[model samples]
Target chain A: GAGVSQSPRYKVAKRGQDVALRCDPISGHVSLFWYQQALGQGPEFLTYFQNEAQLDKSGLPSDRFFAERPEGSVSTLKIQRTQQEDSAVYLCASSLRWTGGTEAFFGQGTRLTVV
Target chain B: SQQGEEDPQALSIQEGENATMNCSYKTSINNLQWYRQNSGRGLVHLILIRSNEREKHSGRLRVTLDTSKKSSSLLITASRAADTASYFCASPTQGAQKLVFGQGTRLTINP
Candidate 1:
């Protein structure tokens, strides 16, 4: 129970609809990451937040994807005009820092389905 | 683009059997890490072997890194049904900001 937690384990949305997914990282973790995992593929990075500052967002597929960690602890990933291609498991991970060689903790992820 | 490639995309073995997965990467890495995902769940960290380390072990898991060959292998001895999952290898390539992952090897342990 002391691990990363993601809200709304499953989400179903109509095409073009908007949805928001939330993630609560492990307590006191300084770095949080957002990744998208399509069926039969590995997780791809979306955005990374070091505390409240979003340092990298190069992996966001499109402008429709927006993520914020206003308080540096709880983060939200909002997708606008969701497309069928956007239907994938969104995973949230946290670590002590953004540097390599650190073990990261992950949440069970939110499965988003758009039809 | 994927940074690593895992061979034999899937493997199945009986309980108590051994399972092996191999991963190859293109660029030099600071470290290589292995993770496991059960069904549609999140990934759990399994082991990490630095580029300089040739081999390491934890419990029934054994990891070997061959930097010269730019590849790595994971061996699970006496695997159990609980080990059924998709195993991914990730590398933090030099000067890369994020870890790049391989397609993964789906391992099934039949009871």
Candidate 2:
């Protein structure tokens, strides 16, 4: 793909339901990131992947929030027992390199609504 | 926690006017980046200024960084209605791969 791609642009789930969001990064991108953006706020870091390795998960809000990049190119973010506060836009970004000066390209985010 | 803080949460300006947005950060960074988002969609990379560089230009966009003051500013010259969007400043977290973003400045370029 020419850019990062996210699946199911929108999702609505029950308060206790579990939901999964997927991301397909640009071909051969070495770094991938996930972020959560609340209404009227900046994107908050959720996790990061360097290839298949999950290098950082400190930003995950809770135990229920999990992410994986099993194959290094495709990643999944799963939220269990979703709460109303969990409603936000989930964003995916990928960078060709992990250097400090490189800019990551973003995908159209998935808007999640927990009812 | 967010490392950067953007000033003037919202700005309304007429087309053809220049728009300036400022951002301040707490920690030292290897680089600072500016991104633009439209209608809550994906973000597009605008420009980046390294900590050592004071200024950079890309098309109609100009970015400046003051490492001494831990601040940065973005200037858009000859703004157009199409330039209306939210602009954010981001800095990479220390020892981390993720970039921490500021709340953002909502820029409205009215005709």
Query: Whose DockQ is greatest here?
Result: 2
Task: Please provide TM-scores, in order, for all candidate models, with all chains considered together.
Answer: 0.98, 0.99
DockQ by candidate, in order: 0.75, 0.86
Question: Candidate 2, TM-score vs. the true structure?
Answer: 0.99
Where's the lowest-lDDT run of ten residues in candidate 1 chain B? Answer: B91-100
lDDT by residue for model 2 (A21-100), tens: 99999999989999999988999999999999999999999999999999889999999999999999999999998776
Q: What is candidate 2's CAPRI-style docking category based on DockQ?
A: high
- Candidate with top TM-score is 2
Question: Candidate 2's C-alpha lDDT?
Answer: 0.95
Misplaced by over 4 Å in model 2 are none
Per-residue lDDT tens digits for candidate 1, residues A18-93, read 9999999999999999989999998888888999999889999999999999999999999999999999999999
Cα deviation at A104, candidate 1, in Å, is: 0.9
